[model samples]
Target: MPLLESLVKRRKNREPLSYITGKAEFFKRQFSVDERVLIPRPESEQLVAQTINYVRKLGIEHPRIADIGTGSGAIAISIALEMPSAEVFATDISSEALKVAQMNAHKLGAEVEFTQGNLMGTLQGKFDLIVSNPPYIQSQVIKSLEPEVLREPRIALDGGPNGTEVISPLLEEIRKKLKPSYSAAYVEIDPPIADIALKTAQAKFSYAEVSILTDLAGLIRCISIENN
Candidate 1:
C-alpha cells in the first residue's frame, strides 16, 4: 500500500508511470526502468518478435545482431534470451542508460555486449540483423507528449523537427554496417510516421519492404523492413 501510494503521488506530479512502478514489460519480460531511460513500449516487442522470426527463417546459426539506442536493453536482451545462438550488441548514447541496460541484461542472464556510442559510431563489423526503436518523436511534440513519456531521456525521444533527425543518420549508418546479404531490420515508430519511415528505408535499401504492424491497441506502431 505504501508503494502504491507513493506511485500515485508521483503520477499526480506527472512522473512517468514506468518510473513510479520501477519496471516495464517487453516481450513478456519485466525490466527495471527509471527517468534515465525510455520506458519499454509494447510496440517495440513486436519488432523484437518479428526480428527473431526473421532470423530463424534465414536458417542462420549463431547470427550476429545489433540493437541501437538500446535504452533498457529490452530489445537486445529479449532477442538474446530467446535466441541463445545470437550474438547481440546493445548500444546507447548515454552511459547512464547503458548502466540500466547492463542491470537488465544481468537480471535476465542474457549475454549482451554493451557499447557506449551514438547510433553505430562505436560499432565494427557487419550484423546479420539490425533493429532499433530509436527516438522518432519530433522535438516540438516532446513538450506536448503525455506526462508518462515526459520523464524519459529527451535524447531518446526527440527525433528533431520532422521526427526523422536521428533516423536519417541511423538509416545511413545501417546501410554501411549491415552486410549486403542481411536478413531484416526492424524499427519502431509513431503510427503517423510510418509512410515516411518506409520511404526513407526504401531510398537506401532497394530490396527493403516495409510493413506496418499493429500493436495490441490496433494502432500501426512498428515498421519492419526486410532487406533480402
Candidate 2:
C-alpha cells in the first residue's frame, strides 16, 4: 500500500517510526507523540511503577507528586489515573512538549497539572513523591548515537559533557523539595552514571536510603532516594 511504502521510506531514512506515526505507547497506554517530544520508553515504566508502589506502600491517602521533564506526560498522567486521589504535577521547559503532554492528559482524562519551567524549579511546597527521566546521555555520546535517536530533541537527550549535568543539580534540589520524612524521589539515568548518581544522592541524603534500581534487562537505570 502507499502508506506502507511511505513508512518504509521513512524508516530507511532513519526517521523514528513513532515520529512518523505521531504516536508512542507508554505505561500500556498510547500517547500522541511528534518531533516536539521525545518518545516514551519501556524503561520509564519502571520509574512509574516504583513511584506508585512507594505511594501505596506508605499508604498515603493524598500524596503530592511531581514529575520533572514530563515530555509526553506519560508518567504524570499514568500516576494520576492510577491514584485518582493523589495530586500530580508535571513540568517541562519546552512549551511544544508541554502542549503534547497537555493534549495527551486531556485525551486520557488524566488530572495532571502541567507547568512550564526548568525541572522542579516551578513547583512550590514539599512533595511526597518526585520522579523524573532527565537527559542522562553524555553530550559526546549523543553525537555517536543511532540516527534514529539523534533525531530526538537534543534538549531531551544531552546531559552535557559529563552526563550528570541535569541529574547532579536535580538531586540537590530534590532534597529541598521533598518532605523531611516518608518522601522519596526516582530518577532515570544512564548505566555509566550509576556510580555518580549514588554518590550524589548519598551526599544529599546522608540519613536517607539511596539505591540504584535496574530495569527488566538488568541494566542500572534509576536512582531511588528514600527519605525515611
Candidate 3:
C-alpha cells in the first residue's frame, strides 16, 4: 500500500515513474536509472535486436559495437550481455550520465567501455556495428510533451529545429567510418521524421542498403543501414 501511494504521489507531481522507482527494465534486464540518464524505452530495445541480427548475418563472431549517446548504458550493456563474444563501447557527453551508466554496467556485470564525448567523435575505431537513439525531439514541441518527459534532461531530448539535427551529422560521420561491406549502423528515429532519417542515410551512405523499420505499432521507429 505504501509503495502504491508513493507511485501515485510521484505521478501526481509529474516525476517520472522510472525516476521514482530508480530503475528501468530494458531488453529483459533491470537497469538502474535516474534523472541523470534518460530512461531506457522498450522501443530502443529493437535497435539492439536489429544490430545483433544484422551483425550476425555478416558472420562476425566477435563484432565491435559502439552505442552513441548511451544515456544509461542500457543499449550498450544489454548488447554486451547478450553477445558475450562481442566487444561493446559507449559514448556520452554528460559526465553525470556516464557515471550512472557505469554504475549500471557494474551492477549488471556487463563490460562496456564508456567514453566522454559528443556523438562518435571520441570513438577511435571503425566498429562492425554502430547504433544510437539520439535526441530527436524538435525544440518547439519540447514543452508540449508530457510533464513526466519534461523532468528528464533536455540534452537527451532536444533534437533541434526539425528533430533530426543530431541524427543528420551523426550519420555523416558514420558514413565515412563504417567498415565497408560488413558494417552497419542502426538509428532510432522519430516516426514523424522517418523520411528525414532515410534521406540522410541514403545521401551519406549512397552504397548502403538503408531501410526504415517499423515498431510493433506499425509506426516507423528505426533506420537500419548495411553497406552494400
Instruction: Output the number of the TM-score-best candidate.
Output: 2
For residue 194, model 1's alpha carbon misses the true position, in angstroms, by 2.2
Best by lDDT: 2
TM-score-based ranking: 2, 3, 1
lDDT of 1 by residue, 1-228 (tens): 998888788879988777877899998899999888999877678878887788878788989899999999999999999999999999999999999999999998999999999999999998888999999998888898886677778899999988888888898898888877756777778866778887888888876666777878888776666767
Candidate 1 collision pairs: none
Quick one: ranking by lDDT, best first? 2, 3, 1
User: 1 or 2: which has the higher TM-score?
Assistant: 2
Model 3 agreement with the true structure over 1-228: per-residue lDDT tens digits: 998998898889999989988989999999999989899999999999998888777778999899999999999999999999998999998999999999999998999999999888888878889999999999999999999999999999999989988999999878766788788889999987888778888888888899999988888888999874
Q: Alpha carbon lDDT of residue 52, candidate 3?
A: 81
Residue pairs in collision within model 2? none
Model 2 bad stretches (over 4 Å): 1-4
Clashes of each: 0, 0, 0
Q: Give residue 70's lDDT in candidate 1 (0 to 100).
A: 96
Candidate number that wins on lDDT, 1 or 3:
3
Give a tens-digit lDDT track for model 2, residues 48-68: 899889999989999999999
